[model samples]
Target: MARNKYDIDEALDSEFNIKHLKRLGTYISPFRKDMAITILLMLTSSALGMLVPIFFMKIIDDFIPNKNIAGIVGVCFLLLVINIINMINLRLKVNITAKLGQNIIHQIRSDIFTHLQELPFSYYDDRPHGKIQVRVVNYVNSLSDLLSNGIVNTITDLFSLFFIVGFMLSIDIRLTGICMIGLPVLMALIFFIKRKQRVAWQIQSNKSSNLNAYIAESINGIRVTQSFVRERENIQIFNNLSKSYSTSWMNAVRYNFMLWPAIDNIATLTTAAIYVLGVSWITNGVAGITTGVLIAFTSYIGRFWAPINTLASFYNSLLTAMSYLERIFETIDEEVTVKDNEGATEMPPIVGDVEFRDVTFSYEDGVPILNGVSFHVKPGETYAIVGPTGAGKSTIINLISRFYNLDSGELFIDGIDINSVTIKSLRKQMGVMLQDSFIFSGTIMDNIRYGNMEASNEEVVAAAKTVCAHDFIMGLENGYDTEVNERGSRLSAGQRQLISFARALLADPKILILDEATSSIDTETEILLQEGLAKLLAGRTSFIIAHRLSTIKNSDKIMYVDGGQIIELGNHDELMALEGKYYDLYMSQYDFLR
Candidate 1:
């Protein structure tokens, strides 16, 4: 299926001021009925609130003139009752808005997470981990605020404007007309400020994302920065990003801070004009222009300014909030290039025979990483692939696991093309240990069990024993319970490798790929690892990529790959007799020994 076309970066800038938000409105569609009821209650609250000024007008115009204490008390009590009801309605509206915002954000976060998991490894290769991390966290946070607070404030402001205007006209039409005279001017100002605010907010969000991306990269590569003594350079880069972020924020804040006061000053001037004109008319002579009516008009005027200010401030808030929404929507719009085929079947159990038939592959177009490579590893046999640093040895292993597909060719495991089977099932039959084995932060037992989460404690201990790691594990302070700090920083390189070895051992796959596994370990640990390897490769089909020929000397076959093609294939002794690529690589190491 073709992918959705949503520009995440642009959306972030515009704050999702697009058709998608209208579509996303459907998420709230389910609760529309409840929302309707809540809005009705809010309207009722607004209506009751308008009655307060009328009650005061009545007290001043009628009850005060008649000197009726009972009437005065009754009107005051009704006003109090209306105030209580309005408060209750407002609280309920807030609660409902809160729930709706949380639900939508939760749904969005979950969908993005699922999409990330479904995306191909190529997508990961192009984007950094820190960049993805920021998107998942900060983007989701922005979406929640936009949907929740932004929507609620907007609706309330509209309703308040409607209710206030209607009540003012009902009380006195001419005075109401006079109060609304400056509205068009205020609105034009608001529109102009909104544009400026939106731009500033966009700048702020972009700068912030850039700062976060840099921080993430710097911290992850902190070791390299220190080793190369690039700390000063890195700090200068951070300072530049931080300055841009702060400047953007301050620009947005400056505009936002000025907006409310500007609106207030305009409203104050309008209110003063109304009071002066109304009083002059009352003294001179005009219809329905009583002192009480003038006072009530002033009260309504004050009420109108509050909502207008709220709306103006909300416009600024929307820019920041919407920018966040755009970023989140962008991620949701991302295409998952790698997805399962509709009729893909689960891989059945196999005897681990593998074949690459006239295979050609590349990580990039026009540059082949492996070309016309054809080889086979029979069941229960060990095969070694010897190659120069970038001769496509690891690429071969990746192809076997289907981490990347062939550009033009077929890969078969037990005579079935791997693409015909579900990727999860295909991977289930294989175990791999890369040159740089990663150990996550967790207890030693937890890290090992990560290979197969359902593995029993007994199974875990047995796997550790098979990899010759059990004794060293027991000698640690807390044994298997010892915490492996972030990236297993607390453990030595050899110890980390042993733990990874134990992890792979626990998986118990029919096919195993070990790439330069013994190269990084100390001699003592190397001996322990070799002993473990003997037990591991005994009756399983294995593929080994190693720099040390001694590690794979006893393998059934050794294939020497050069220039993306296998130049020679034979057992170790046969390769030595040929005195070709294999002999040269072996002798180079022998010279170091001499």
Candidate 2:
């Protein structure tokens, strides 16, 4: 079944595969000693437990019948000792497995988060942030129970089944066969329910993810919604998503709740059959059919079905947890498309000379964003790029940052091919300020310090002053120490951009990119920031993208980009003299102002 939802769940392999089990060995491998001890403890406790019913049978048959009080008391003491041993085994098992489970969870979470860090921008560009957050936080937590107790209990139960069956068959082959009737029935029930249950849970997972994605998006865009008077419409959409989630959840749990009753019914019917047949056969003076033996056989029947019940419950739990694991591992297994190539080296000291030779690229295959465009920028020069929206202007800055690999041609930095160096080293030498300035939840001092962690507070203050942010920041009650929330909602748009300027310049990068850096500020503030911009750009190669022609008229050189290629390239004065596309663009803005 498919639902009309924003988050489309990827198809999972519904068929049960042993590979999932094998894959678990990677995490469990670290705590092999702990696992071995936990399994041994489980088996030992189960063994001790199996002997209880037998001892009870002995008391009824051999001890009380012969008036042997001493034997009864002796067996009673042994049972107490066995109980104590079982308790100890359980305590140890919980301690070891609990610790092991936590460690495994940490490792798996760390691995996913680490992989996410290495994954290219394109990975996140295609998915919602909330969907990614759920996998990292929710899906990993779901594995806790299965990792903690399910594995050991499953192994111990399987062994106990064998031991119990052997003891039963030795007591009476005919009765044992009668008890065996329920095993196939239980298996058949699971066989029928397994696929439906898995599919139901998978759909539930999809709905949950969709609901989370929508909630996150809604919260982030609440300001827009309120301003546009879309609150009622948004609430209606949210209600629909909530209802869908509730329905899918109930459907999944329907299959989950069905197992216990069916298993119990089969066990109840099997036990009743045994009692009727045993009593009738004994009345006919059947050979080797003593009262004690009949009692013991019934006792073993209860023992036999208990594990089957547990296995049934665990089987259900396994199928449910695997739905979550499928997503978790799928994320872990997502290939790091833009990572350090083999034997990639640290980038050498940058001189800011940048060149793109016949470079081609596309966010989607066959839908090219940049078509074989090429350019060269000399060190210490400031270049401004002007273009209409979707004309691949920002794509150039991103290419220079090496956030994306070229689709075909080569991009070189300081005459070195970009792909030959490690990404961390490459990015460290350049500073980029995007249109949206994201602030972490911390003191303003900490936010600016994020650029260069080793910079002293004095350095941070110096950078803030250079960006014209110091006057407003000092105007606050706490000055640089004032706390700000993530996304910087407390700060004005212009103030945030000023802080962003401080952050970008704090790194003292050789190459700097400012994409619409001053668009949000008024002309008066923009004029003040230009002095700070002059200081920051001294001896550094800079690329500025802006629609306001007044801001970039004095750029060392300007390139009017359009239709996936450069249409005009010259200094501001030269471009104005050419009276081509650049002149038309500048004249239109000038005419509007005039």
Candidate 3:
């Protein structure tokens, strides 16, 4: 649970257009076989329906006039048979598209989540976490039906419109011309609403993202809010986001609902004109426009408009999906700034030796976190980094782990450039214990096993024991099997750190990074942890960032970092003897305590 960088009211642009259709088509490509089958079935169903009106015309003109009872009964049976086939086709289409829709949703969401895992920390630092979650969950779900049913339905409807119009013209060209008078009106209405409706829906989507982001941030910071008695302020912020969403939603829906009524009215007027004109020609005894032909022609008019109405709904769904897909693609398209280079190989066994030559890096351009800073640690040595707030102490550990590529420089492990190896292989051999140690919701044993998935239960317990966590864990009612919620609410902050320390230890890494990992532990617990760690990491290379004097006093070297450079470096006594930055920092703490 972490708060976002910006306010919830932050506005977003509506970039929804036809461009995302190409990316969406790629997802649909894998299931083209199912789509082909669905299309064939739907067209067959439409063809079957089209035959019914013609059969009725035969009964009206020939069967009933001659008192041919068998012909009328046979036509009824044939229509019934046609309807049963259409029903069967409808059922099969539903089955295929249902599975198709879910599979596509699964694949798209999996791709988005996988890309998120590969994204650098800087990508996350720039956006709200909830925004990313929405793309995977909400945005993908909203487009599922559109990708499946809406697509196939629109295709069949377009083909159906063609067949109906062709039949109408065959009956009587004059009557067909009258029926088509509404086509331009329907097209004009759709064109006029297209951009406005898409923009409205896009606004609604942004508001929804904002509301969800704020809700997630509020839940994470509930303790802080309650501590400061700011419940009323949070409620006000939520209400404002919700109101914006509601307004945009109403506007989009108003435009959406407008299409149906306008289309229905146009169809109604056109059908009336067809009835009047067709009957007038038949009554006048015009050639090729008999009573049977007039009846069949009017039926085709209904069939023609039916698909037109449905096509409008499909257009609405497609536009809605376009707005959502824009956000989803934005996340999927984010660059992986720290990925491996071409021909990168798996990192060979990491030795303790590490070096950074003329390294320069930054979180933001023109604002260096570490500039031209260089350091080297010998095998089996411990080095501590000490610095003021905003100094580059944490950046050193981050660079060691290769979380971000250096803006300009070379970082080597055991004399081999780190950029020459696969990121997974590089990180696998290291253990990092950060200040904010996240404990997922599960049994304590499960949490520890996460560090080493292949570790036996005995190994997990041994690591816990080495970190002085076994005593407290065994003291719990269920021992190591006790369930803990996320952030380890059941355990104290110090206990959580002990469990995290045990997790990191279980990795058995050659290079260990502890970034303020002991800050939460009590004096007594810290002392016990230090005793265990001294023996455990004796032969390993370890980097410890600590403010507590006792924690780093025995390090082989200590560096005082400030203004993006290591201003002072030496062993503890040697640095204190120089009366430099390290001495002043240590003496200040010493004075504060005394």
Candidate 4:
């Protein structure tokens, strides 16, 4: 499945989408005041830039021709002042736009993260973790260039283009006409190149996501890879993914680099044509053809193409950013499959009576994992569920916690429909510990206190003692303060399980779930841990899923499940007396138990 996810091609939508642009604009709406000031600054800077060429024209046609030293000096001073103002406005514009861009990206990243948290577990079940991480971190960051400089600079370039065109037309309409012969050609080239660039960029982004996903998966399974001596195979896979990413990047960059030279060639050719035509007209003594006018027109030609070149570059960047925007919005616009319904209220403290009324469920496909399963447990009862590997034991626990919604029936806790109450309220009263206990990178104390943030240091210690974790914890160099490296890599499996027990105990939940909780511990350790668990489960309703049947022998009710159906339900002695499926399972492990 991971390979398939990595192999999927990222197809781009339209090259330049106005809808995506408008949606992006909504992020900037909150900082309108900053954006407005930026726009004003951009206009002022561009206007000043346009005026500098006009001043050059004035020096050539008016001040220099009139032999007016005082006029030339005054014009020079005025040009200097204009340039100073332009520089100031440019600086302020950059500062404001950068801040605005960062803020908008920050908000977008935050929204994506918050929304991801609200999505159903099924959403994650169908996606790769690294792919989602890329969208939140890399794709959103790609918008910074476009937001910070692309929009404002593109507008400024347009203004400069117009101002230069108007000034040239006012000077000599004939020359202006000749200089613009390359305009249509340049526009066509840009349009053609933009489409290809968009496709290339989309491919590049997809490859990057694939590479990241592979890296994340590889790093997570490095131990397994090494243990199986498959390092060479993993390296080969990584190299292939990296090569693909590099190829896509090169393709995108080829189009980007292609545009600049294309624009430059056109600009250069147009400038040469203007100079030749202006000189010929002057030699032929055509009307309105002066040396000053010719020189100024030459200067205006450079200014004209400068903005055109800038706009063309901005167009390329805009296309690339549009691709990133499409990916980002795709994630942000995903419908949250699970959420609180309207008028849903918080549930009061639970009494731990859980009931499943003919609950049926499946994953993405409609093949039922739990079909017409019905059960009920009274408050403060310990219900043990024993089953084969895929016989729906854990599915029952998931349903009781409302991690998933029922397909055909209802689940109730303390007589209240679970779906009728807020998810937060429903989950707050339940504590769960699974077989693959996850330990975060933090001090042992912090990891334990994670179950109850408000737990004091004393409470944390007490909980650790209750779970038989305090003795080993105290033996460590830092005791409770010992940092468990990422996923508790420094600790043994049994040590991690003990800490998980402490975390669940800290919560003081009304209901508890232990899924193979003692499977990793040795018999000696399991015996001590069971002592702690006995006290922990004394008053709370508990569900235990265990392959080691002895761990659940004391459960008030033991259920043997097979093929998503409860085959036997009785106490330990009663099930043994029946000599049915339960008896056979026990007999198979009888030698080990003895």
Candidate 5:
């Protein structure tokens, strides 16, 4: 069994880029009408909010000084109306943006899943399941705020800043000049902090993926851990992963918290400067400077910093979200390595003739698993492949199914190159059963019906009966309806294999490939399985990979393979007469049986 290793030191080169936003915009484009309405509402709300400080300024400079009761009452009423409208706009904007954000997330997640299905098997061979799951679930979820509040609030804050600045400069350019001193410094500080925060957040995100991968791998192999009495070691490993994740998160938090104090200190110092300079200017007999103007200047300054604080928060969030965005787009941009050629046609129903011509394959460069191998099988032929472990028996079946593209040469079915046909059409007519015998979490009926979704209940039971699985299934508490837990942990290995056999048989495939299909079965069950398999193999072309010599004795032809090359090809009696490699292997097993 291959162990899943979690490598935390892997380098992720996910620099923030504008093109990521452009690609993300495609998902958002579908809801452009709703987003437009949201933008309009946000603008209206910010415009109304900016007017409130002006109302206060007016009451101090005009209504209070004139002692006009009607003016005060009228201004208060107008302020109330503007505030009510602002509240309404804010509520509507939240509704629109929230729904639009969720919809965009749905579209993005759907696209990622669809793309994952199209990706070749080779892509998955190099990645961990948990890491991919994190991208689909956790990473995509991290974008919720960026799509909702980030876009809306950033726009609102920018407009509010523009309006607040215009109002402040109109009141007193001198006071505004004092307030403006900190603006450049604050912006520069934000820019500097953003760079550090981005790196911290990227590290944190990577740590999160590492943690998820570790947990998933540990849980999947909990049985092995317990079997070896290594639970303590596993727990220690988990603790290490958790500690690293927490440390990275705290580092990011430390950098993020730095932003708030920096912005606040600048705002505070600017306010203090305004008060000191304004008092000095007024007391020194400056012309056209009054108490009301001074009061309004303070009010404008308060309004000014509020948006700055909001923008600061938004910037921090964008930095964090950019890390997730980079990861998500990275997965989305992965190429589908195995795809039909241009103008490829749908494969017609197979007559079960498979041929490999000068096939060469390798998982990596310069390490060939299959080197220039060629063979042909006619329709309804039972071809058994007997090989030592790692002799490329399974690779032959994987190539026939088009799971991975060949590095060179051609594989054909009924004279049509497998690569030249649509993958779905080519794979639909083939049934494969591997040694692992994986069973999903579902009732026995559903598991069997998976091979043919349109198969009726009676047809499923019939397939089960044909595989000698009906007897054991009926003995269960709920018969076909009995629930199988995850990976069929509730069932024995032989039972899972039988269920998988039933699934493959239900498909009624034209070509069947059994890679150690009966490895888990006992002698008694094997006898019954062979009886049913004889009937099943009557008219279909089949390939069987087996280590047990007894299983392939009755096969029409047995090809003995070793070191990626065929050493002998004949029926059992003919190979025994030759006394070659196959004869020695058979006699060893024969003596072991005796």
Candidate 6:
């Protein structure tokens, strides 16, 4: 089982503030009835467990030496029945607790996924995908262990200790006191061991997170690694990380080894002292104490020490489990910065007009990407934006889609401020095709239908044909049913681009944004796609950002962007007449094309 990074530390935290357990209690509220039943079964199983030792004591004191055959048989039968009952109850308890653990894990996983969806892109921008995956998957699994086995073992251990100690005291207070003499020292040693190893455990946890991150990144970028021939270098780096993790783990283990033996020795000495005292008392004949009672007391002493030992060691497991809870809570506590306004209503159907008025925006505070930038595209008009790299063209497109909120701006679609409308409705009105397109590992039909999941098979094919994607798709071995493995790696770049076009067409968006959509296609395919593009661009307000200036020369307007500002805006002929930024860019590109 993969342990979560948080388990080690959070579990340790529980020792200090057990009240934090209330949080977990609240999380389990929905299944309280099931939990209650599981706890009941656990308590019953614990009772049955304690009964076995008492039964043995009875057999030893009453039936064994007397050779009472009927008494022996009855006791044996009772022991066998109790054993069977204990095993049955234990099985039921484990199964129910296991199910409860799974249900809680499922709920947590689902909540994490839903939260990810609600989170804005900014949250992902600064975080590693591997780290997120670790928290969601590995962490949840560890939490499952903590919730089921951790809880069950802890409750049973406490109950067993209470009953066992109470019974031993009832038999003889002096022996009981002597047997427990070593516990304070053992507990102190446990506290010392935990304190000393905690930092090492924390270091190990951190290294493990790094190791997981490294593996996740390396696997995902294996192509990059192989292409660059960095296999040996990566292996060395991983080895270094593994060594660090091993060293930290070993340090903690060393402390554990030293601490346990020391505790065992102390407990052993205490037991020896008890035996010596008992022998001296029996020899003196002060109080009438039988050899049988002393023998039974000796057995009880062994049982007591073992559970105490187990309970002492259990602190580590408890600490680790609490650590996992901390990490889980940390993730759950993360705030989604962007959310819908209260009582927000969905916008009406779009008529394709879009306007950005005095929009100023920045990803981080004060580092503006777009400043006082404004533009408008009339209904059914196609506007092309020609810009150098980092000229905020994509930023403008993102703004229109409200993928980000502007610092100070009023972006309107069909004359209503975009923020005033529901984000879902606003996004539903736009279609986007980027240079790098995504295709899932599924049938071509399924990939296309992703744009409109409810679209019929006939509709999917019709949409593909509309974008001139049908010929290439049908030419494949399985036609529309052919699987595209791993982001369409089985297909060519142009093929993926075509599928993307088909998807956008299926969406039938009112506003279209194409960011270097034809940049990766061959000249022949690009020329063919231009015909389809003309049809797709009709009846929609379209914004095209491209370095291929000739492709959008016939667009209603051309905007030349430089240094985060629109330097020129006019028709093709008008820009050529000006001989400004747009003219220079076109002339420079003309030399290469020619």
Q: Which predicted model would earn the best lDDT? A: 3
lDDT of each: 0.81, 0.87, 0.88, 0.86, 0.86, 0.77
lDDT of 1 by residue, 265-291 (tens): 878888988989999989998888998
Candidate ranking under lDDT, highest first, comes to 3, 2, 5, 4, 1, 6
Give the Cα error of residue 501 in candidate 3, in Å.
1.3
Q: Tell me the number of clashing residue pairs for each predicted model.
A: 2, 0, 0, 0, 0, 12
**Ten residues in a row with the worst lDDT in model 4?**
1-10
What's the residue-level lDDT of 483 in candidate 2? 96
- Candidate 2 versus the native: TM-score? 0.94
User: Clashing residue pairs in candidate 5, if any?
Assistant: none
Please write out the lDDT profile of model 2 over residues 1-594, one tens digit for every residue: 123235466567656666776787799899988999998998888888778777887888899899999999999999999989999999999999899999999999999999898888788887888788878988888889888888878888999998898888878898999998887887887889888998998888888887888888899999999999999999998898888889999999999888888878888898899899889888998886767778988988888988877887788788888888888888888888888889999999999998889988899888898888888989999999998899999999998888888899999989999999999999999888887887888889988888889999999999999888899999988999999988899999988888887888898899999999998888887898888788778899999999998988878989998888888898999999999999999989999999
Which residue pairs of candidate 2 clash?
none
Of candidate 5, the 10-residue stretch with the lowest lDDT total is 1-10
List model 6 lDDT by residue over 1-594, tens digit each: 123221222222333446546877766788878777776776676666666656666677777777778987887887788778778878888898888878878888887778888778677765666667777887678677767666666666677778778778767888888887787877677767675665555556556666777778788778899999999998998898778779877876676576568767986897788788888887888474556557767777776766666665566655555555566666776787666667767989999888889899887787877888888889999989988888888888888887777789798888988887778987887888865688989999999998888899999998888767899889999999998897898888778888887887788899888888777778877777788788878888899988988788889999987776788999899999999989999999999999
> How do the predictions measure up, each by TM-score?
0.91, 0.94, 0.95, 0.95, 0.95, 0.91
Model 6, stretches more than 4 Å misplaced? Answer: 1-20, 193-199, 252-263, 286-288, 305-314
- Residue 379, candidate 6: Cα error in Å is 1.8
Candidate 4 lDDT for residue 273 = 87
Give the CA lDDT, 0 to 100, for residue 511 in model 4: 93
Shift of residue 302 alpha carbon in model 1, Å: 2.9
- Over 4 Å off in model 5, which ranges? 1-4
Clashing pairs in 3: none
Poorest lDDT segment (10 consecutive residues) of candidate 3: 1-10
